[model samples]
Target: MKILDKYLLKTFLITFTTVFVILFFIFILQTVWLFISELAGKDLDLILVIKFLLFSMPRIIPLVLPLSVLLASIMTFGNLAENYEFAAMKSSGISLQRAMRILIIFICVLSLVAFWFANSVIPYAEYKFINFRKNIAQAKPAMAIAEGQFSDVGFYNIKVNKKSGENGNILTGVTIHEKPNNYGENKTVIKAKDGKLISSEKSSILKLELNNGYYYQDVTPKKYEDRSKLPFVKSAFKKHVINIDLSELNKVDTDQESVASTNGMLNVSELRYTLDSLNKNIDNEILSFSENINQRVGITRTMRAVKPEQKKKPLPNNLLSLFKKNKEKLELIKTASSNITSTIYSIDTTQKDLKEKQRDINKHYLALYEKFVIAFACFLMFFIGAPLGAIIRKGGLGLPIVFAVLIFITFHFINTFGKRLSQEGGMTPFMGAWMSSFILSPLAILLTYRATNDNGLINFDAITTPIYNLFQKISKRFLPSQNPQ
Candidate 1:
């Protein structure tokens, strides 16, 4: 290797490593803050907490690695420019691109490693993290229910005023709200003065025993007037036991909604397989629904067997006239109206269901595209940072840090916004995942082209030099200059 190449590599490596560690630590703190509810006051073991954080730490690499590369590149090149090292290299017939050759190769290699980590390592960590939380919640159901606030655990939102036990199994002033079910309302509520959570190591159920509690369930009436009275079924019990399935202990602990979306748990090939199956299932469902609807409104055997009258007559102006009695005509109209309404309702409901399935499919596509995005982000950030550093011509922690933060925040914000919009069916997953990259590519190209040509970020000297001359002329015109009086 040439001396210049080795020097450049060493500088960049040292900067990248330092920036990566600092940024990783900052992001890890943010992660801990996000999941503090699950970790704090849960009576969890120290090793368990450490394992939880370790599993979650890998997910931060995609964010941290890219930002670190960006900051490092900017700082390294900016520092060289600021210190006139680039000036020395340029005089030695070394162009900016020549100096960056080794770093470019290094970045390409890093991108590949990033892609592998996102595909293999991150997914495994997500799976482990999710399941680990689930196991913890199951073993200690109290973790799922925090004191003072209602914590969502499967079908119930449970709140406890106080918990006093080694494992926080003994509760006081318990309140439970059953989520909406067949009743279509969260009307079932249970309150107890004292409660105890009982669970066995071998069992997959948490038995909550409530003492001196009242169970109240709303009973909706068919008549609107009767509903206004708000009738309810209330019963007082000396001791009541509610069995909760451990499997449904709110599988989400870290993310917005991980359990409902298993895309995080699957690798590339697995996601593709799942997507294919989901597509097929949706197709079959639509075809089945269409056939069923056809049958519902299809012409029956009786209609096919009907014979035409011997003498053809003009149809009546009013179809109701064909019926002998007015009452019979009214009955016919009512039946037809009800049937039409029901058919319309069925179609509407099916359309909504199909839309939901499509959104899920989009989420899977987004996840698949995300692995590629993180890999490409390395390349993207490097290009932007390297050229920007050369162009800015200022270095160190202050200016480089400011620039890195603004650029990264823009990239991250756009990426996050696009993902959310894509998940909501605002755009295709492909466009959503690559939107930020596309938006930033132009800046990188512009910077790189200008930097290669030895152009400044802006023609600042042209602007400033003219202003300086104008001010000098104005000063001479306004006041007499006395050299030696």
Candidate 2:
């Protein structure tokens, strides 16, 4: 690399790293705030918390990277411009376009890296983070039942007056209150002298066994609606078991819906597969309906020719009754055919709805694909940034950074709006995600040319100001009247 190119890269790298660290720290702080609830009253080590944060970092890194790059470029070029190093470079034989080639190359590399991280690393991190949370939640019940505090686990609200550090295996002075499920069944509340949490050696059951307990239960199930008091029975027991299913502790994968089957989430391939499956189901349903209709038509024809006169031949009473039963059978078949037709229509409507849902899933993957593609903006920024710096006769972090940030923010906002439109099914997937980039490409080229020729930054703020003013005036005119109405 030439001296100029090497110098530009060094400035870019330094700025990028500094911004990345700050952003990463901010993300970590946000996470700590979010998960503080889960970490309460537990002897959770720092290593475990750090591991969770690290696992989460990749998932959010894609979002942060683009902004970081934008900031780095803006600051790097802005400083260079402020220092007038760009002027010195221009005074030499180094042209603006020549100087930008190195920056462009650097951006290309960054874009590729961003793409890899977003598509692969981020998805895997999301999966792990979800599982980690589930594992923690599974252990929450034990952690929740602290000494001298009321704890609610599942359906039971219980309190323990005191607990010893002896393996945390036993509690004393236990009081329990249980509420019936939604089905109006009676609830049993138990008061015990002590309780212990135990697990079977070979099974996945978590058992809360209480000792020396008197259980109180309402026997009358129907008396919940009436205000009349119902008598309760008190039974003494030496031990009682509250068994819990451990399988409920597993992390729930949202994509494990029936439509998804085995595919973890609705990726591009999964969306396509689901669409095909819905189509096949619809076809099969139609074919089944057709066969049923044909059978009904055959039954109707067979019954039509069953002549009453021909049936005068001597026949056993059972046989004659059997012939008579054909009429009712035919009528039943006709009713069934009508019901099937109605059902077929309903299925058709349902299939259409499923197709719409599948389309929505497709829209999401399309957006994801497009967002990854926008990482190529890393490359584009270099094109715009490098040339602007050279033409403005600057090489420092000051002016280049400001210009880069403005360009990136404008493009970023446009990209976001387009994606939302796509997700809402307002715009075609390609158009919504890619159109902003396409529209800006030519504009970026123009800006690069002007900057290379020392024409200064192209200010489109005039055009935007008018649109903003128009919205402001419209809001002022209409917003106030609607409030009273």
Candidate 3:
């Protein structure tokens, strides 16, 4: 039994390592592709790019590990079953459950490690990745400008129709919209045939030198009758220089505390604290809103003062007198109605804001639950893959990869769909987080039972036989007289 355990552990580890590396590489490549636009044309050093990729790896691990476990378990168990090793173990009176005991322990440990990685390591990585990207953006101010798009640099919005030159410093068909200061009546617009950017590490300003440009500035007329004239100034300049302040971009802050409150940057404890704080804030907001509404509407539980046994007044005989008596009451009713309408509108706005805040809270809860749920997925995948492999008896990557991908896709889809539902308030955070595992666990158990009993995993005959018969009947009914012959 000890020999068997050692052999099984050895085989599982080898497969797990191989699958993990392959999946990690594939996912990292995918990550690179996803962010290529951000990293490309930035003239970043090789080291910075590598650092970006490295920082991204921790986030990928949580996604990759479970799929690797699934693939490894399937391939390992399928090879054993295909080679008749399971039969030999059974002949020696070893039950399937007993055979899996050691491997199960190993998987549980892996799950715990996964949890620790998600809770501790990934948060730090997330913080680093975010700040690293920010640093990259700030490293080269020119990188922020893409060809044929509006780029915001300080107070100006610039658009370039074409870019050329070795360093991409030369811009053609340049358009710059300069925002106005407090005293300026309208924005200053500049269009140039060509422009060149000049900046240096020592300087705290970016200078754009424009050639053959036209500047237009609108002027507001002081008199109403003169407004139709729409006074403005348009001037053509042989050369013009625009200065942009870059002092803020030169500094990169590495303090993690700056982003500590973000959902992805916090550990479980921090997440819980943030969630509690948000809920308390929401409660206070609701209480304050209610109080405001009560004050505005003059709501009170106290009874109105009773008149001291006053005699009933006789009705007014004249129409003018009656009209005068009711006019004051009608105006009071109109004023009360308007106040009620305004209060209702205010309440509606408050409810919308409260709902948005609640959704944000749900998002935090989902993130909190995801840390644990993703870790537990490793164990669940192993259970599912091992039994499935044993039942299929197909070794190697051919069939196992297909099954692993299909199962993983199904799991991922359910998880993503549930998360979206939670975000939209269609589902509770807990239910959304665990929905995939809840669905797959029962299938894992069923597969295990069928595999252990040596019964067909899918009962293909039961499903296919009826379909075949139905096809045959359809064919006979559709055939011509030649079918009788």
Task: Give the best candidate by TM-score.
Answer: 1
Superposition TM-score, candidate 2 onto the true structure = 0.56
Poorly placed runs, candidate 2 (over 4 Å): 40-43, 142-244, 247-360, 367-371, 384-413, 458-485
Which residue pairs in candidate 3 collide?
none
Where does candidate 1 have its weakest 10-residue lDDT segment? Answer: 249-258
Q: How would you encode candidate 1's per-residue C-alpha lDDT over 280-336 as one tens digit per residue?
A: 999999988987776777655565566666336755798887899889999988777
**lDDT agreement with native, every candidate:** 0.87, 0.66, 0.85
Candidate 2 lDDT, 383-480, residue by residue in tens = 55555554455434465556656776788788788777776678777777776678777876886777766776655777789999999999999887
Local lDDT at 389 for model 2: 50
- lDDT per residue for candidate 3 within 101-204, as digits (tens), equals 99999999998998898899999999889778766656677665556877767788798888777667789999988866664433578999999988787898
Candidate number achieving the greatest lDDT relative to the actual structure: 1
Which one wins by lDDT: 1 or 3?
A: 1
Off by over 4 Å in 3: 145-203, 206-244, 253-257, 300-345, 461-485
TM-score (all chains, Cα) for each model: 0.77, 0.56, 0.75
lDDT of the structure predicted as candidate 3: 0.85
Models sorted by TM-score, best on top: 1, 3, 2
> On a 0 to 100 scale, what is the lDDT of residue 184 in model 2?
52
